[model samples]
Target: MQMSQLVLKTLREAPSEAKARSHQYLLRAGYIRRLSSGIYSYLPLGLRVLAKVSNIVREELDSCGSQEILLPALHPVEIWERSGRIKKMADVLMKVEAKSGDFVLGPTHEEAVIEAVYQDLSSYSDLPATVYQIQTKFRDEPRSRYGLMRTREFIMADAYSFDSDQEGMRSSYSKVYDAYNKIFAKMEIPFEPVEADSGAIGGDVNHEFMSPAEIGEDYYAKCSSCGYRANIEAATRGSKDADAQGVGSELPELLYHYTPEAPGVEKAVEAISDLGVPTKAHEMLKCLVAIDGDQRLVMLLVPGDREARVPSGMRLLEDPEFERYPYLHKGFIGPMNAKENSIYVVADLSVKERSHFATGGNKAGYHVTGAVLGRDFQVDEYRSLVVVRDGDPCPRCGSALTLIRSVEIGHTFQLGLYYSSILENARFTGPDGQQYPYYMGCYGIGVTRLIAVIAEHFLDDRGLIWPVSVSPYQVVVVPLGAARSKEIEEVAETIYSGLLKDNVEALIDDRKLSPGVSLADCDLIGVPYQVVVGSKSLKEGQVEIKVRRDGTTTKMPIEEVPTRIRELLGRSL
Candidate 1:
């Protein structure tokens, strides 16, 4: 495309709301325009990059024998209700009311896709099938920021696989997993696949492809000894006391003490020590209350040294919620005197090892000095819910754990009959003439978020240095002294036309702009290659080619420039 005819404008400064470096460059480079807080419009240059991403996704999924099918963004409310996700994801689910009834802007297509495919497949003959779609998706993000990294509406490639049996489902899941690795490798981005929680998707086993970044929101722990990596939600630490012989084995008996001002564990330990009580911080139980979906308080007794880890399977209630139950003390709280059957008490598995531990007194200014788990107060159940610490032992090989921030780019779930069993008519007749629910798996790639991810990871001070696979244009021809020298313009245009004829994506700066401005724009736009047609270089029977990634420059014949770029791209034109 001719630069003079295109409606492109480069900005010297990014908008005030831009936080991430990639977002700033994307705006200044004239690739995208913000329409609202979390909504954006792709400019001509941005559209080209998105198109390349879409084509790559299609190629990978197609090669894996997955059929492509587009489902509607607008779905009936009944479908989500039938899948039981209406209540599960009500916060982020965008619901609309029409005169006819209610409709939902689907954040996912599981309910719709299953309902559609289930209607036509009723026999065991169609045992295994896969369908996917690359389309727009919507979610009501409370705080959308960092450009496309967190947006309310964006493009996504979501695929679902259905099989007749568990073995077939496992095979289908592995195939999609393999395809995901290929897809990211083709895009040339560094990534890590970590074990993950299923979340509201209601699946059994899942994995998330995380791209490490300094500004990532997700935190994960990876063990060096066993190579076990998992997102925080799925990460776990063993209970300090899994096996025990007797209660308070090291200590004599359960002792109650009066501590006037100590509320937290650290201060309580200090106050108890001041009173000549000998105890370590780890030999204490931290008590916290969380109201479940039923609005009932569930008490968690975690080891004092570790923070109370609430499982994502249950949501925690807020501070204001404690007002409803006056029996529960805000800071100094425990299960011994939780006020008349109003709370259900549960303890962490780690608590069992602390034979004689300290606990909250349930009364302000009072605490228990020597508390035994089975003797003082009985717990309903013990769970491995301790929050994994930085130096925590690895669950597998007992090595120190490492924490890192990462971005979640892709996720795959073995959705085993969760949606199919819930949704109506999502069943098939087995060879035994009995009806069975379909085993399903879901795979997703954030088509638009990848633009921000690639830019964020593969960037320098100059601007966004995109990978050749996803760069808007592989080559840009910036003719130095274009308006001053007709020969340079003719040579640059001839080269650009030839590159196009050779099926190589190329752009030329035909505008009457200064050489500095043209080159700066080229660098900011981040096309993989830049050809500079300077008069001096032309006089020397050569032109200059700059590699955007490494800033390497090579002087080559005007005729050989396109060939070098194609070779660098490592693909046919």
Candidate 2:
């Protein structure tokens, strides 16, 4: 490709909004242009990388006997409602008001694809089939930063599998699981599979393929001992039941002290301890009021030192929600017998064991010490919950688990009948000739996000360092002689043509630019190899070859440059 003819625009400085390394290089290299917040336009270079990524995904899925299919993006709300996700995903779903009816830009294809398949497919013979599509998906990301890493609209490869039984679904899932391992390996990025919560998608078991990166948005725990890995949302501590420091029939008076300055648990703990009570931060109970999906308030009690983690389908009470619960003291809320006030309580398992823990007195500027578990507050059920932190115990081996930051590139869910059973007319006949809901599995790979993740993982200070499998161009021809130099121009063209003849993607920098300028962009563009035809090297009857990944160069005879380039690229001329 000629640089002059191509719509390539390299920037001297990355846009101010492009903060991440991948985002900075991509913008500066003229690979992508910002369309709006969380949205972007892929230029020619970006499109080439996207194409290579899509091709890799298609080839891998095709290898697993997965058939390709495209589902409609403009979907009726009825399908989402039928799947029970209309409300659950309302926050991120992009809804549109059409002349015909309300529709949602499809974020996923669970309902649409299954609705189509169950209409036509039946019987055990058609039980196990995986259908996939590489297409654009939409999401209303609340905070879409980090360029392609978090986008409102992006490309994705989503696969849905149907099986007669759970066993068939497992088989299908395993194939894709192994295929994902192969996919990331082929892309040359370091990744780990972590157990994750299947939020909104409705699955009991799911694994997110996470690429370890410095600026990753997700945090996962990997056990150093037994190799237990899980996302923080689903990860658990290895410890046993919290000790209920046995309670007697008689209870002591709960000590409530006036603490006007102590608004938070930490401050309250210090104030209470100064008032002749021995206390520690961990000995204090922090009470929080959160509104559930039903718009009812639920009380949570974590240790004073721990931060609360809110999972999907639930959010912390906002100002409006707080206004509804006027009786509950703001900032000084506690678990009281608030059932009359429509506030239910659920405490962490650790809180159930602690005797004489400290908490808010449900009154402004007052905190209570010697607060008993059953005597002061109670929960309908004690859930095994603990705040996730670095070096937390591993659920598998009881060893310390370290939290690793990662980018979620792919996810696979064992979505057992969640969609097929919910959507209308979605059923299949089994070998017993009895109608049963379809056993389903869902898998997805973020095509655009993978590009960003790849750039983040493979690049260096100079610019993007694309892996050979996903580089926009395998080799770039840098003619060091000015465009007026016929000899340099001829040598560069010959090399570019030879590469094309060998079925290699090559970019020819034939523009009338200085060698230094062209070479700099060549490096920033991240072509895997650069064939430099310089007058200095040409005088020695040699052409210079520069390896992009590592700044290693070799001088080879001009006659052997094409074959040498092929050998260096691990391809044929």
Candidate 3:
């Protein structure tokens, strides 16, 4: 590629909407252009990087016996309805009305893949098959920010595996898991594979590959002592035993007091302090009312310093529900009167060990001191209900946990037989003349988001410093005094042609620009290596090879530049 002919224009400043550092650089570097709030177009430079990542993914998955197949982006609505995901994923589903029938832009290909393969894979003989595709996916994302990190339309490499039994499914899953490790390894980014919750995917076991970054939205907890790591939604902490024998065994009375100005936990703490009680946020009990799946009213209790995690299949009480249950005050609800009001009380494990709590008085403008868990308030259950904090004890080894902010780059799921059992004709005939649902697995990699992740991972104050594996071009040849000095242009063209002949991806800066402008542009473009063909270096019978990552320059013969770049790329790979 020649700089004079390349279709890109670097910007002096990023767009006003661009907030993340990588997002700003991507626009300023002329790699991508924004079309709408959550939509973007990749220029030639960006597309090349995407293609390289996709090729690496293909190589790894193909080596593991997985065949590549492109699935349709438009899927029949009936497929999703049959699988019961139409209602579950209603928020993100992009429905379309066509002349033929109703369809949806596919956010995932599980149902479509099953609809295509169920007939051919009807027997156990055709077991343990994996098929994957690199294609575009659409989702009606509510908050798409950070450029490509969260977009409405993006490229994803999603792979699905099918097997006859549990054992076969495990084998297929491990193969894909190993393939994912290799794929990210080649990308040369720092990432950790942690246990994660299968949110809308509906799976038994899943893992998310998280790349730590300041702009990340997801968080995971890692134990320092035992190496136990999991997503914050799925992470667990150590539990303590109850101080008393059982609920309501002791008669620790509650001392009710008036606190007219205290409506929230923070104000309540202040009011308690005025009464000569120095209480921290964690020293106060926080009560939340929610309705379980069974429509049972339940009160969840946790410390004021922590967030209560609403159990799956349950939702917090909304405004109408609060109006319906007038006795449950918004901020003054407590467990002391839960039994009398026929509301079940669930408390965190830490509450059991605590001797006393300053909590709500079951009335507006009031609080109570000397409220004990087992005595003053009987808990129906003690479970892990709070979000894990930084210093929380690890569930495995009781070590302190470290929370890390990260973005999810990839995910693997052991889907089991959920999808096959729900979807029709997704079963195979066994040797005993009986049919069984196919055990399944899913793996996904964000193809376009990786560009942002790589950009954010390898960057400096000047510009992006991409690794050799996914850099837009491995080498950029810049010639100084191209219009005035014929020797410099000749040397640069020779080096660029030789690099191309050696199968190295190289670009020649043929534009007649100053040395500073040319070198700065090369740095901003993030090519790993720069062959500077200056008049002085050409007169010395040498060309300067500048390493973009470390800013190191070495003078070498023009013929040696291509060989040295190939060596560097090989080592980096």
Candidate 4:
């Protein structure tokens, strides 16, 4: 591609609203232009990059026995309702009304694809098929910022596999996992596969492909020594051996104290200490209120030495069912008052084994000390309810788990029968002649987000250093000051044509620009190899060859330019 003909508008400064490096560089480099807060129009350069990303994804998906197919972006609401996601996804799912009735922009195509497959493909013979699509997806992000990272509309390459049973689902899931690892390696983006919660998209198990970034929304933990990594919500902590201070024989009787104006835990603890009650003799029963349809109590009993917060896996606030449980009082909630089926009490694992501690008095400015679990209050269930902190032991290895923020580029789930059973996407017949819903496995890659993530991982202060496998062009030929000089233009054109003949994708910069402007634009666009033809170098019968990643430049004879560029790109590509 020639720069003169290309719609290339290089910017000296980035937009003020561009918060992320990828966003700024992409906008300035003329790859993408913003249409709205979260919507964008991919220019020629950006479309080329996106095409390369999709091609890589297609190769991997094809290797995993996935047949590519495009599904409708506009889907009927009845399909989503049948899958039980319409109500659950009311917020993020983009709904629109047609001339007849209501519909939704396809966020993910599980419901639409499942219904289609059920209508067309049935029987065990058609079982265990994987269908995928590289298409645009729309989501109504409440606050869309940071470019493609949290876009209201972006491209995604989502694939779903249907299997006869759980065993087949596992087989397909492993294949997809292996393929994803290869794809990321090819993209040259360092990532960790961490266990993740299937939020909104209900499933048995899911794993997120995370790349370390400061601007990431998800908080994942990784053990420094052992290399064990997981999303904080799904990650587990190693068991700590509690102090063997046997339960004291003279355990104090539970008694209520009138505390005035002390509502929070710290103040209540301070009031207890002022009353001369032993801190160890009292368990701190923190009543966490969550609404499910009515006010429900989630009780946490932490040791006096340790503090407690809401656990990650607990569906307290984010759950759609919480809207119904609106009566749960916030801040001033407790476990003592029996509301006759008005509250559901869940206890943390740490609280179940604790001895006596201070608890809410179920009233304003009051507390009860020496309250024991299973004695004063029996919990509905015990859960791994403590938020795993840094320096916490790793569950896999005994090493400490350090929390790290990362962006989720891809995710794979062993969906089991979650979607299949709900949608009744079943197959018929075996030797036993029994029918059952197909087992499912879902795999998704944020095709556009992966591009941003790669840019995040591999860019320098100048601009993006795109990996060869996904770079828009394998090599770029920049003829510095070629607009005025015929010799430099002839040399650049010769090299560019030779590269094209050699099957090397090359961009020829024939624009009327200075050396500095051309070089800066070359670096900003992030092509791996650059062949620079300037008057000074062309006079010496040589061209300057620059490697974008390390700023390594070498002088090559004009005749050798095409061969050297090809050799470098061949090895990397």
TM-score of each: 0.91, 0.90, 0.91, 0.90
Whole-model Cα lDDT per candidate? 0.84, 0.84, 0.88, 0.79
Best TM-score among the predictions, by candidate number: 3
The Cα RMSD in angstroms, rounded to one decimal, for candidate 3 relative to the true structure is 2.9
Query: Over the stretch 181-281, how does candidate 3's per-residue lDDT look in tens digits?
Result: 99889999899999988877878788999999999999999997988999898887787544644445354457787888897789999998898877788
Pull out the clashing pairs in model 3.
none
Off by over 4 Å in 1: 238-245, 248-253, 257-283, 288-299, 312-346, 362-366, 378-382, 571-573
Candidate 1, 300-388: lDDT as tens digits? 88878877777655666578876777776766776776536557777777766656578788777777866665666767777767767
Candidate 2 — what's its lDDT? 0.84
Positional deviation of residue 268's Cα in model 2 after best superposition, in angstroms: 3.7
Relative to the true structure, candidate 4 reaches a TM of 0.90
The residue ranges of model 3 lying beyond 4 angstroms of the native Cα positions read 99-101, 240-251, 255-264, 267-280, 290-298, 321-330, 336-345, 360-369
Clashing pairs in 2: none
Scored by lDDT, the top model is 3
Residue 25, model 4: Cα distance from true site in angstroms? 0.4
Backbone clashes for every candidate come to: 3, 0, 0, 11
